[model samples]
Target: MSGLRRKLLIITVLLAAVMELIDTTIVNVALSHMSGNLGATLEDTTWVITSYAIANVIIIPLTSFLTTKLGRRNYYIGSIILFVVCSFMCGSSTTIWTLVFFRFLQGLGGGALLSVSQAVIFELFPKEKQGVASAIFGIGVFIGPTIGPTMGGIITENYSWPLIFYINIPIGIMAATSCYFLLTEPVIKTKVQNVDWTGIALLAIGIGSLQTVLERGQTEDWFATGYITLLTVTAIIALTAFILWELHIEHPVVNLRVFKSKTLSVAAILTFITGIGMFTSIFLTPVIAQRLLGFTPTQTGLLLLPGAIIAILGLMVSGKLLQRGVSPLIIITAGFFCFIFFNWNMFRMDLDTSAYTITLNLIFRALGMAFLTVPLTMLAISSLAPKDIPQGASLNNMMRQLGGSFGISIVNTYSARRVASHRVDLISHITNNNPLTIDRINSYTAYFMLKGIAWDNARLKAMGMIDAAVVKQSTLLSYTDAYFMIGILFAVTLPLLLFVVGGPKITAPKVIVSDH
Candidate 1:
């Protein structure tokens, strides 16, 4: 490919990847509007998000095999078409379930966009420039989700909720068209082998069940619900069996053998931790801003923008350093410490915290992640043969996704339990005879009386208001506690960096062909 054509291809592939990722979080802020418009209860409306997640998790691990089977260029084009068509259908649906189904199809299509885009981008460049390729792809991976909610909020506010999905149609069409013309299929070919059907079934069952339990568990009050219990058991059994089967199977759907590579193993572990911190911080910050601090969706999204910019800078700087022979271990360690500092700062957040404070802390977090993410991608693929790079990348990506799911689930569960515990502690201080309690109640009563409430009614109203205030305070404290918990997790993981096997420093190779 010519220089201009290669650049255009890279731009096209990056756009497609970003489009896929943005869809993952874009619908989040618009869920309420969707529920109301579709005439579905909030709980049922949640399936719209859950369906996409389930499809994404399932399809992600299967991408390597699917690409081999379908041919990369054909598969890439097909996925874009599928995504665009589904987006249109998702927008036009008259009922909630129809939209959910379309979203699932969209997820199936979007799942390949990330993995294939990475592979295509890698193939575009030569061996030595792999670090630069990774840095470029890193932007889409990290920035896409951060930007999703912000862009979604802007679209929903200015237009309508359906426009969020509708907006993808034009972009998807252009990407698909460009991909068909620009993406060249590799000449190398492989024989068709029987796919491990059993492995696929078990994987889908295990991951799908596990994701369902995680996403729905909090809303259903965890183990208190019968369905959650059953799904939990099913997930455990399916996953255990899948692991065993993959170990023994002649041809597994996912190549579990890649984990045997020491570099890949260490990278996977670190990637999982990275996912935990990245996803949890993003997930928790929005809730803190919108729910606790009373920021609008647009305001909350804008607050995160600076961090994303810092992260891009971090990626570029780290990429250049790696190209010059910086040790992966050192860069990763620096990242871990930066991440810990960021979270530690977040632990001090209050209801009145300023946007600049949050933005600054997040920029540190982004820098930390930039140092970590690119080198780890290099570490994971460095030891593998060219044929195995895609498989390794797919597995690494899948683990990160699982880590995010695990982090979200654990954080939500812990936050809920903490709130209850704090609420109990707070309520204990509300003894009827306590002077402070009496004074607080009297002040509330006076406010109610001024609003024309009767004496007995005002007292009851004041007590209820006090109870609500106490609950809010307890929840706020619990959120802060969660931030501290994340900090500790990052701090503890720092020692493990010693074990990662850093490859010998070499100059990055030049680009011979454009994979994009």
Candidate 2:
């Protein structure tokens, strides 16, 4: 391929991948707008997010199979077209369920965007320059989720919610068109000997059930809800069977044998852990900014913008270092510590934190992620045969999505319980006999009285204010605890690097095709 065509294809796949990832969190800010506009309760509207996530995890592992069934060029373009059409359908839906169904379809298309794009990008460059490819793609991976909320906030606050989905239409078309003109099928194509229908069924049921449980568990009060409990059991049984059955099968839909590679195995686990920190931090920062500190959606988005921007350079630097044969372990270790530092800084944050401080703190996160993305991608697939790259990419991406889901669920439940515990502990000290408590209440009452309220009514208002303060303080404490725990989690996971056998050897992928 000529330099120009290669660049265009690179741009095309990266754009599609970024679009897919953006949708992952973009709908978050618009859920309320969607709920009110569609006349559905907030709970029902949440399926818009859940359905997309479910579709993503389910389809991700299937991308390798799908690519074999359909040629790479055909599969890539088809997925783009499918995504574009579903984006339109999602925007046009008048009902929440309708929107959710289309969102699921959109996710089905979007899943391939991430995994396939990674494979294609790696195929674009030679082994020695593979780090550059990783860096290029890393920019999208890091920036996509980072800017998602920022873009979502801008659109939700300034424009209609449907515009979020609609905006994808032009980008999707451009990507599809470019791929049609420039993308090529692999010179050596691999075929599935037979369709593993049973493996497919097990995979769908198991992964789908597990993803659903993770997405909805907190909202439904975890296993306390009957459906959540049932799904939890179903997920365990189905997943165990799926794993065993895949290993037993001749042609598995997902190649279970790839986990035999120690590098891939360790990389998968590390990716999941990274996903927890990455996605959870994104979740935590915006919540604290908006809920406690009273930042506008745009303002919260802006707070994250600088870190993401600075990380672009960090990604390039890390990729260059890898190209120079820096041990993947060293780079990843440095990344881990950067993120732990980020967690520590955020743990110290209070309601009085400035946007500048948050942005500076997030730069650590951005750099941490920048360091991880390239090495992890290189490490995961470094030992795999050329043909197995797609499968490895699929598994790696699926782990990330799952990790984010689990992280968000765990954090939500933890924060809720912590808030309750802290509130109770706080309330215990707010007795009438406590002089400081009495003085605080009296001060509130006098403030209300100055507004011309009756003494008894003012006193009642004062009590309500005190209760609100307790709730707010408890919420702050709970988030700080979350930050502390997350940091500890990162610290604990660092030792896993010792298990990585050797530095990654990024070889040129033979699976990518030359221009026709």
Q: In angstroms, how far off is 52's CA in candidate 2?
A: 2.2
Top candidate, metric lDDT: 2
Off by over 4 Å in 1: 35-47, 93-97, 219-224, 501-516
Query: How do the predictions measure up, each by TM-score?
Result: 0.93, 0.94
- Candidate 1 lDDT, tens digit per residue, 265-305? 88888888998898778777877877778777777777778
Q: How far off is model 1, as Cα RMSD? A: 2.6
Over the full model, what C-alpha lDDT does candidate 2 score relative to the true structure? Answer: 0.85
lDDT of 2 by residue, 419-490 (tens): 999999999999989999999999999999999999999999999999999999899989988988888999
